[model samples]
Target: MGQVHQHVHIEWRGGTCRVKWWSGEYHANGRKRYESKGGFTDEDEAVTHGLDKLYEIRHGTHVSNRDGATLMTDWIDAWLGSLDHACTTERNYRSITNRHIRPFFARKTVSEVDVIAYRAFKKHMKRTLPSSYGNAVMILGMILDDAVPRLIKTSPVERTKRRGKYVKTHTRERKKDVAPETVERLARNAEILLGYQGYVLVWTMAVTGMRPGELYGLTRHYCYPFWPASDPQQDPKEADRYKDDKERYGRDGNRLPAIRVERQVQFGDGKREFFPPKYASYRTLVIPPFLAEMLARLLALHDYDWVFPARMGGCLGSANFSEDYWKSISDGCPERKGPRIRRPLPALPAVPDFKGKRMYLLRHGHKAWLDEDGHSRFAVESRMGHEVPGVEGTYSSVTVAMERAIMTTLQERWDVAAKDGWGTPNG
Candidate 1:
């Protein structure tokens, strides 16, 4: 720790009781010395006052001092390193956290990132990448939530929300994964011999409405058919899942079935690992009926390995998978001319040449179906693994069953749309 020394001398400035003293550092590396505020009535008074100011100066952390290499920056590294997530995810944190939030707030200790700075950050993010900006805000809030108490500083962005129009460009908004129909067809079109592996992957997301990260994070061990009997795995999850519940089981001390979702596949750092899910979905992904069966069957047959295995049968980098145009690997899809007909979508999609789109359109379609069916936004939002709009009782209102219902609706819509040609005009 640094030391402090305060010398007081009586002085007069504008006929006031002011003390002359020096605080903090006595000198810079250069010729500049410590500052002097002259004009004090008595030396004792000046000395006493100077000591307090010096204490505040030496011990009182300057807001500016909090800017360089603080706990906030440290926590991000710790958090990122601990992730079992895919490469894409790690890359995203590095790119977004380091490039955007860190450079801006890395200097600010957790407490230093107040609402004003948060708002300003949000505004800046909106200008660069609206969706990513919003995500950054959430990540920032999450990282700080655990850090504030530890750092003894307040988290500025906590409970803050952005309102009014989203600053996304229309063209940018249009450019994401194409509609779900295209994604479905893309899956079907891949036509790999692995028994609808591509189809099921796409279908599961459409049906279950789980996020891509959730799907990627899955391990063979996590999926099992929900047989109520005493299995080593299934029973423990239900008991421990609601461990957070005060009632544990509610009035009857019972929770519906519990599903697990502990990991995610992210396209980051040119590699992938199983990272924690973006939200609560990381721990559990509530599933609908057909989906439970489907997941179970897939797991049993594949031995709980990656639902989609690379040629190497190891963890596949999300970025590499996406980059390789392996979106649809079913036997059904045929490549004609040059392109494989369907490439994983990153741009606002146009109709594909050979009839199939990318894999994400299904997710998009499911979201649409959920919204149309009058499912509560919170319920739908939860399934999508996104923050719900408005600060309503979203945290409290939706039950696991309701979340399951949202998944059910998504699957139903996907099945209907798939048969109907992915809600596209195909005869």
Candidate 2:
């Protein structure tokens, strides 16, 4: 136990009192160290403050003077250094920290960032950077929370409560899914604007629900059924293992056509590279026969490394694809004169409900389609590359029947669309 001592000053008319207390901590040289606070006229108030410090120390909730003085920038650096995140994720964190966190909390100690300061920061972010506000707050909270008991006592970031429920202060507009007919219309428009490749790209996204990055990064080696058996990239052992499996090959002794989603194109620090799919959700997607035929035709037309390449024969970047390809497809392009006077282009009609929308909505629409078809939860989640939570995910597994059913339903939809003359041209 430590005791508080009173100090008297004779320079004033009457006197003054102050207190200091120690909690049995020692310095390297064996000198006794103490935590002290002055300027209290009342001895009782000083005693109360000392007692609170002692209690905090005993309960292991105390923030030491040195630790409390740690600047927010220092803590953020230490916290970020301790984490192991993906390259893109780390880049985003650093970007957010430098842009929002560092400037606002510059030179402010961790302990000095009280609830009021945090609230003010939130307000500033909401007004100036509404789109990035939520992510900034989340990253800041993570950094501060990691400093507990070391740099600061506790985090000031708290959830806002309203009407007996906790809700997000900032919300974004939800992306809506398009109907199957709308997808076909988009495909038709894409064909007119970007040739057969664009038509295949739109249909592939609508049916497979692949992320834009994954679709753009897809190579010929991963596209099965069309992937050459004698190709050097083909694993002989893997092929031999599944060669006799009836469920995998089907009862008719024919191999299933599928695409292996193993990698995605990632652009970071102005460099484009191949990275594992998001969440490392490497999966094989089974395709219907009609789609397989479409892929076959597409492959026959090109010997490029990437299945879908830009007009310049390079991997399609999302931004460029959106602006040069997707925008013209979704928002209609005016008729223009071609190089040859007799081959003038005709005006392309816009697909309804698709204006100002992102290509990602096709993924959402695919999930909805699977759900509407009454597919099993395990099958649907697996197909979407999502991990089902809880015991259901642990116990359930996607079966041959599920894949067959999915293939059958997709083929039926293609047949119906083809009957309506919406199928790919010359496919």
Candidate 3:
């Protein structure tokens, strides 16, 4: 049972009615606790509120005001500490928390973050950080939902649904695809700008659909012909099976060469290190014969550990590579006059349909090529290192016929490009 009472102030100057207060008593862990709320004008209303509180406590749905008073910043810290995310994921979450969440809700308590406050935060995120708005909202929801009844009764963030239909706040833009001829043009332009290595880089990305980090981290040990045997990350059982099949020949034998995608280059805390590929999609990619030969030639020329080292040396960084290499390659570099120029550098022609486009478009182009070739969905998705959801992924596997068809199609494209006067580099 609970009690409702009104406290009258004799020294009051203005008010004729005294405010009523309500309180409920409960026991837990061999101790008695009190839950209360004040500032009701009617006695009956105060009593009803007290009874509701008592009912909630009895049904194990009571959320204490004291616990809800915990600051959002403190709760976020605790939540982040409890997570066991990967290094890159952890870094992203910490960055979003510090840059967006903590700054906006620094002074607010967990319980104070109601629907109104959440809506205000959403508008602020959309206005100031439109590009990161979705991610910020997701992170906030995760943090608040984890609080549950311990800090707050329920989360204010609700799913965007309208009349039983899910609503998307933003429309996703489809990735642009680069044509085979355009890929050739881009590779030639890269050669003109940064030499043969740049040409090879462009062609490899277009043909194989490798991510920039995976390409940058590609070492001689992981390249075609040397991989599987030299790949330290490969499972021992799989390596043994490969070795056993080395001398054996099937109807569709191991004609196509492969490169192992075991790791990717990651730059963090002012240093570079190798991390598993995105979503840990460690896989082997079968390459066309021409690409295998091109890689061999490139390796013969460079004794460096990395297949594609920076012009000065070491791994190619994203910022510098994008500015000094990809920008000039994708978008034509205008001939410039300089104090140190012995002769004027000629303006390079930009690749058609690639102006102001990202290098990732090449990966998308490769997938488009696969889909255009009428390859199986399972095989194409597997080649692109994407996991297909449900039973399809678990049961379906990339077959030897699929690999052969891919190799045949890619080789034909290269031969056609060569006939069109876009021959391989002499180096």
Candidate 4:
């Protein structure tokens, strides 16, 4: 057993009082943690500071005066290494810290940071674009938030007042959504440009609200045509077990086919690979009958594990999909007036809303469709692979009624698109 030790030391020197303490804790290497705070003109102030330090130590929130002697750059490097962030997230954080945070606070001690210094940092960050500035400041705040109890006594980036009112250093911009009709038009055009792959990809994303990465990572094994009895929120083993069982199909004649969102293909560490979905976005989405039949045919044709593979094979990374396929279809749609590329495509009309928009807008369109149909917030969020937040998220589970409603809405869109001749071999 380790011995308990704690004490505060006070000293008076040339018209000033200095206070220090031994935190009664040992580092992993077995060194005692010592802390000190100076610049107290009064003896009472010095004692109060020392007592506060002792309190922090006792409560296990103490940051050593000696331990934080490392420069901000070194501290940040260590802090980043210690985090369990996803590869993509870690890469972004490192980029933000090196490019923005490090230049401003590189040589400063962690303990020396205060609200005033942070305010100056924000002013400097304001020179960049809003999105860039907001991301950098948010990353810095996260770094500082993690620094406390290890490298510093407190975080300087916490909310502060200006002119007796609270102010924020960053604001997240809202996602812009497009109409479902725009999605159908894009899908029809995609079929003309890239054939079956593009048609299915566009339609699925527009109706399912799946992120690009999640769609890229989809596999035949993860697609279940039946309802799962086990609680997906419980554990991975249970979820896996539920997915593998096939007898659950046709138990409820009205039940729809479901797709499990378990993994995402992301680029990191100099290569792209399949990993679990971001923020564990592991949930099941019920597909409409038209989509379910389409998927079944797609699987039967390929007989490969990946639902949507790259033209060359393997998982389709974002760059290849965005630049090669999406851009080609979106940009080339305005042209091609004559009966070129097999047959005439009913005088393909230019879509202004699609200009400069991203593939993610399809996902936003799916959410809009759900909202338009008056699906509850909880139901929509769950299908979109987002936690609803607060007590509602804790208690909420996707009900059969909610799933059926989503399925019916998506199926209705498919019926309209079919009548419009979407996915026809010849335009």
Q: 1-427 in candidate 1: lDDT tens per residue?
A: 1123334444555655455344344345544233344465555555676666556556653222233236667867876667564455556656677777778776665655667877888778878887686668777776666554445345565453357665443353243434556555555543232234545566666655566667666555554343222123434756754455322222123443334565677644345655667654543445555555555655555543676554345554444554354433422324334376443322322336322444455567667867777887776666566765565734546675676566566556556655543322121
| Per-residue lDDT of model 2, residues 1-427, tens digit only | 2342432121212354555667558889998777666776776777777777778887998887878999988888887788777667988999999899999999899998887888788789989998898889899888878888777787887765423345456566676656768888888888776667777888899889999989999988777554434134445766653343324642135557777787899886688888888888877788888778777777778778878776557888645788877887888889978776654556888876787788888988899889988999999998889999999999998777888899899888777756445555733
Ordered from best to worst TM-score, the candidate numbers read 3, 2, 4, 1
lDDT of each: 0.54, 0.77, 0.76, 0.72
**Model 3 agreement with the true structure over 1-427: per-residue lDDT tens digits:** 2333332111212432222222234466745555455565555665666566656666767677667789998999899889876667878888998899999999999999998888888889989999889888899999999998778888998775434445477786555666678887888877766567778888899889999999999998888656645556446767665663343212135545777787898777668888889888877688888888878777777788888877555787444677777888888889866988854556889875888888888998899899988999999898889999999989998877888789899998888767544546634
Give the better candidate number (1 or 4) by lDDT: 4
Residue 84, model 3: lDDT of 75
- Could you tell me how far off, in angstroms, the CA of residue 259 lies in candidate 2 after the best superposition? 0.8
lDDT of 3 at 1: 27
User: Which residue pairs collide in model 3, if any?
Assistant: none
Question: In terms of lDDT, which candidate is strongest?
Answer: 2
Candidate 2, residue 38: Cα displacement in angstroms equals 3.3
The 10-residue segment of model 4 with minimum total lDDT is 224-233
Evaluate model 2: give its TM-score.
0.82
**Residue 141 CA displacement from its true place in model 1, Å:** 14
Can you give the lDDT of residue 268 in candidate 4? 81
